[model samples]
Target: MAPILQVDVDALRQLAIDMAHAADTIHEFDLTQPATGAAESLESSSVAAISQNVSWSLREAYRHLAALVDQMATGTESAARIFEAAERSFTGALRRIH
Candidate 1:
């Protein structure tokens, strides 16, 4: 029996959510005048971090699914089938990343 254990997904989602909230808060601040330097820096960095987190999470999700699919493929199928399934998912994830 092959089992998948994922315990950090919530941490990843919460991190992204927090970054998004920070970005939104900074974005709404009045920009016509000099704003808090720390806030501006936070906004940019937080947005970039959120995007990176999203990209990484999405990639990892696909990789995890591919591995599971590969495991499923091998129950009564050849490695070629598993390879094809993994390739298909990897291709999809690559497309999504782009």
Candidate 2:
């Protein structure tokens, strides 16, 4: 049987914050310098273009990842609230029964 895992909502939120910082870091790269090559040819431009495209794509991917992480954190917090409410309700019910 698989062990049940308990997650801390506050920790998840912190992780989301960390992911957002990482995404910001990735988006801060400067890709203005052209690529180095053996000769001053079209290869440099092509390489530079490709590098810029890759960097842009990576930044966008990280941005999306951070957004997703934020959503997870929010969901976890909501779930925690719901669980707390349920526990309170259950406790009240037990008190009434006693």
Candidate 3:
């Protein structure tokens, strides 16, 4: 006997939407100005340079994370559409057999 597989495509679609929203929120956040201000307030030039480097690193990391999340949302949305299409096809086949 084969096991039955159930998928909630609507939930997948909603998850994709939520992920896209989260990615947008993360991308929109600005960390550069505050970091630059803090760096400027520092007394030592070397320390300020390090602080700027750290800020740049953090900003890049956030950008990368946002891009990854956006990709995942796109993939999830594609999966939902594929699943829905498959389900519709299966239902149609069953109806034709009856």
lDDT of candidate 3 over 27-58, digit per residue (tens): 98799998889888994778888888989999
Cα lDDT for residue 72, candidate 1: 44
From the highest TM-score down, the ranking of the candidates is 3, 2, 1
True-structure RMSD, every candidate: 18.5, 6.3, 3.2
What is candidate 2's lDDT per residue for 24-67, written digit by digit as tens?
A: 56555543343223123445466656666765666677667766
Question: Model 1: residues >4 Å from true position, as ranges?
Answer: 1-45, 78-98
What TM-score does prediction 1 earn?
A: 0.33
Better of 2 and 3 by lDDT: 3
lDDT of 1 by residue, 13-90 (tens): 455455445544443444323333443565757664555555556556655655554444343244344545666677
Backbone clashes for every candidate come to 0, 0, 0
Please, what's the RMSD in Å of model 1? 18.5
Cα lDDT, model 2, residue 82:
67
Global lDDT for candidate 2? Answer: 0.57
C-alpha lDDT of residue 63 in model 3:
95
Q: What is the lDDT of candidate 1?
A: 0.49
Local error of candidate 1 at 27, Å? 36
